[model samples]
Target: MNRITTLLILALLVFSCSDSKGNNDTNEKLNALRVELDSLKKSKAEASNASNKQIATFLTFQENNAEEAMNFYVGLFENSRIIDVQRYGKDGPAKEGTIMVATFELNGSKFMCSDSYIKHEWAFTPGVSNMVECKTNDEIEMLFTKLSENGKALMPLDNYGWSTKFAFIEDQFGVSWQLNLK
Candidate 1:
């Protein structure tokens, strides 16, 4: 081998080593960037969880006789109260001084209801109704027959294949009800 050839070979090896080192530095920087992005996503998720721990669902009912229905309902439940009461007279088609919305709690379940119209033959249809869940079949049958006492049954109390027991009815006051037992 000649002297020039040896010098050229050494210079090429040095240049290649420098380039590999640069590449390793670049790869390390890229890896750090990726880690930072993942940490940001995790931080965002944790912040959202800290802000709200649970999600709540609320149901609103429109009754023909809010005042009468609310009063009747208040007496039926143990812990029930008319949280907010409003009366509309000469303003809308609501019974003057009647309940606008009877927001109350029944067995710790929050509910809001209002009478949309003052005098109308309209009644609560099965299209919209409150469903009560029973832990046992006996409770289901008891509630079903009791609610059916002065009400009409849309579906008879029986062993519906879908659920262990179930029933549907509209109470005497025209309020629809549903009992589900599984």
Candidate 2:
């Protein structure tokens, strides 16, 4: 009887020690998971804050003409200029010196552009267009003429009954524009 009691006490001690070790391992795993979850939440919050700060119109050019188009637009608008441009290197997927990304402003409106290395089946459609409100007749006419050059004019500058002067045109870069004289 004495020997049996001793064996039973030893067995209970062994089982209790193993159970305590298992609990410690589970607790360690849970703490690690909680830390990872907290990190992920912080990263998501930072990204959301950055996105909310500013959102600009992004244009993807397939023909490596982003710089040219940006320059043309900057020249047309009154308070427009190129903010920054990053070009690809000689070992690029696109041609060297082609715009990887470019930021510009057109009459206080922000825009972003990039030269695409991949070919896409879809191009710009007329369903969506940039609408410009011109403050003068000359502004509307001049913009229409310049934008219509080497491009198709969807709606020539006319009364259209809605405004004194309004024109819709697709520029050489295939981007559509709607000019209205206010």
Candidate 3:
């Protein structure tokens, strides 16, 4: 029924039916079994890879504080951790010790953030924001309080027609977030 059992049965059948002396029929059967085993292994590998793959969101900042933002955001979520970061070298293009690129996982979701060497006129806008679906009131409240610190609250955390508690905030780093109790 299971993969291990099926493989064991196939192995038994292959080895038991094979002869000590090499024969054309036995060689053909062995080759067939080997092919089937290889196919099964490949199929298992593909399935595992598909399930483990994750989609990531990328954010960039012109203020050269990507590391700070990544630390702040990752600290707010549960079961979160910083993965890896690449820093700019002592070059003229980007300042040394600044983040060139950084990757982190917040609540199991992957995120990529970077500091831009060139400044852009356009910064973060309310047109796009990260939406967080929280399970408890405390979660929504904490997220709203932390993310709105030194930033503007687009919508105060309150009851709405759709959710009991909801808030839209632009974080100190100019990233917007919409927190809702689900």
In terms of TM-score, the best-performing candidate is 3
lDDT of 2 at 172: 98
Worst 10 residues of 1 by lDDT: 53-62
For each candidate, what is the lDDT? Answer: 0.64, 0.85, 0.85
Worst window of 10 by summed lDDT in candidate 3: 46-55
Score residue 62 of candidate 2 by CA lDDT.
Answer: 95
Error of 1 at 60 (Å): 8.9
lDDT of 3: 0.85
Give the alpha carbon lDDT tens digit for every residue of 104-162 in model 2. 88986789999999999988888989999999988998999999999999999899999
lDDT of 1 at 85: 73
True-vs-predicted CA distance for residue 35, candidate 2, Å: 51
User: How much is the lDDT of residue 133 in candidate 2?
Assistant: 98
How would you encode candidate 3's per-residue C-alpha lDDT over 32-84 as one tens digit per residue? 77777788788788557545857777898898889989999988999788878
CA lDDT, candidate 3, residue 93? 74
Ranking by lDDT: 3, 2, 1
Candidate 3 deviant stretches above 4 angstroms: 1-54
For all predicted structures, in order, the TM-scores are 0.52, 0.70, 0.71
lDDT, candidate 1, 79-153, per-residue tens: 565666767677767657756665665554556667666445655678887788787777777767767777899
lDDT of 1 at 48: 63
